[model samples]
Target: MPPRTPAAGSRLMQIGEAAERIGLSIRTIRHYEEAGLIVPSARSEGGFRLYTEPDLERLAVVKRMKPLGFTLDEMRDLLAVLDALATADDEERRTLLDRLGMFHAAAATRVAALRDQLAVAEEFAGTLRARLDHHGSCTT
Candidate 1:
């Protein structure tokens, strides 16, 4: 097995460094806050948002979900499910797994829809290429 990467240190990092670590712009992080995906652990004396290790991990989850076409609400629901799982007893763990299965089914539906849309786009591109080739022949 590969060695584990150290989690972000528990100390608060300035927004720039945290953003760099997470591969997002500070503005995007702020937008995520506005969207209710993450809340900073605390504010500095200067009133800047201060993030801790948990926040960084949460941001990583958000980043992963966004590219997978999860809406902010879906991401929040998934996070809530994960958070509940973390604190769950053995019986609750079973419930959480059931809930997660539902979430996965919904995500798969979304992925299928996206795939259909992409196939349409590919077909359009092929038609466009044929049209361009025909026009090129006429121009020549």
Candidate 2:
């Protein structure tokens, strides 16, 4: 059987393109799919996974969360909160918002920690460069 293409004017793309556009490896995307973090928007007749813009957006969220040290379960929970916010009733919306706020706070803390680590690393590199300069200047 021939491979099926996306419908006319559709913005769907195959997994490779989706991975590239989302700045994640194809393997990572597949792993996310296996972890229930995302689902492809469609599949070609040949069984190729296809993704739409929203699918890419979902992957993007996971990508951003990774560097912040969020575990798969945290990522999945955050994604679920985001998904529920769209059409949630007022009471549910309030609960979801609270959860979202907690995630935001956690991310902010993690980012600050990363910044501190980066500063320390940069300082260490600077010290090494200073030592090299001093050694190179010595007359022997």
Candidate 3:
């Protein structure tokens, strides 16, 4: 594994605080662990998950992937590809670079799909607003 970045502070946070910091529910954070997406930085003496800044950054990546609707396997693949790219050399570096390019293309596709969905959602919202306005004027 590539070395994790040095955390700004050595202080470790429990799972709840980590979840709050990442804007995800505790259960969701646990689910990410279960999915092998992110591992806690450490375990306390009582066995509670302890998270550091690097761990939070990993969770943040998963959060961004969640919004883009990336599958668990896709997330795992991307993480592995990124890790490899960081330390790859020569031939391996070229292959990892190609993999990164594929991920970029896939992300662009997902973003375009999201844009289409958003446009449809906006039109629906506009329809609802018009109906609400009509009903409000009638009710008055």
Candidate 4:
């Protein structure tokens, strides 16, 4: 199959296309914009949000954050930390690195919580399978 095409003229992608590429919904992208986590690279003449490669990169960061159960405010804070790293002085960069470290710790905690939840879910599924095997039937 041929590679997908970008929007005509400019290389920017429309919001729907961007969401599809990132495995997210347009509503989620809009929410991220509202949360000040990311902004569209441009708006088309028809008033649609258009995204560039850098914009997609930002979206990808937010996407990763979501599965880790990061709050919107935490997401915003992390985005600020990332933005500041670009032009921060050494001392400021050190501070940002500290902030980034905090986020990493939080992610680790969340991942552990998710693992516990998954274990419970799998145990429940196994019990159900045992019941099904005992009866050789699946009613309700």
- CA lDDT, every prediction? 0.84, 0.90, 0.86, 0.85
lDDT winner among the candidates? 2
TM-score of each: 0.75, 0.91, 0.84, 0.85
Q: Order the candidates by TM-score, highest first — what do you get?
A: 2, 4, 3, 1
Q: Where does candidate 3 clash, by residue pair?
A: none
Error of 3 at 80 (Å): 1.0
lDDT of 4 by residue, 49-126 (tens): 888876888889899989898988898889888878999999999999999999999999999999999999999999
Residue 77 miss distance in model 1 (angstroms): 2.1
Model 3 scores a TM of 0.84
Clashes of 1: 0
Q: List the residue pairs that clash in candidate 4.
A: none
**What local lDDT score does residue 119 receive in model 3, on the 0 to 100 scale?**
100
Alpha carbon deviation, residue 128, candidate 1 (Å): 0.6
Best by TM-score: 2
Candidate 3's residue-wise lDDT over 63-126, tens digit each? 9988888899998888888767778889999998898899889899999999999999999999
For model 1, residues 1-140, the per-residue Cα lDDT tens digits are 11123345558877888899999999999998888888887677999888777788999999987866888888888888888898899999999999899888977887888899999999999999999999999998
Candidate 4 accuracy as lDDT: 0.85
Worst 10 residues of 2 by lDDT: 1-10
Give model 3's clash tally: 0
Q: Residue 132 lDDT in model 1?
A: 100
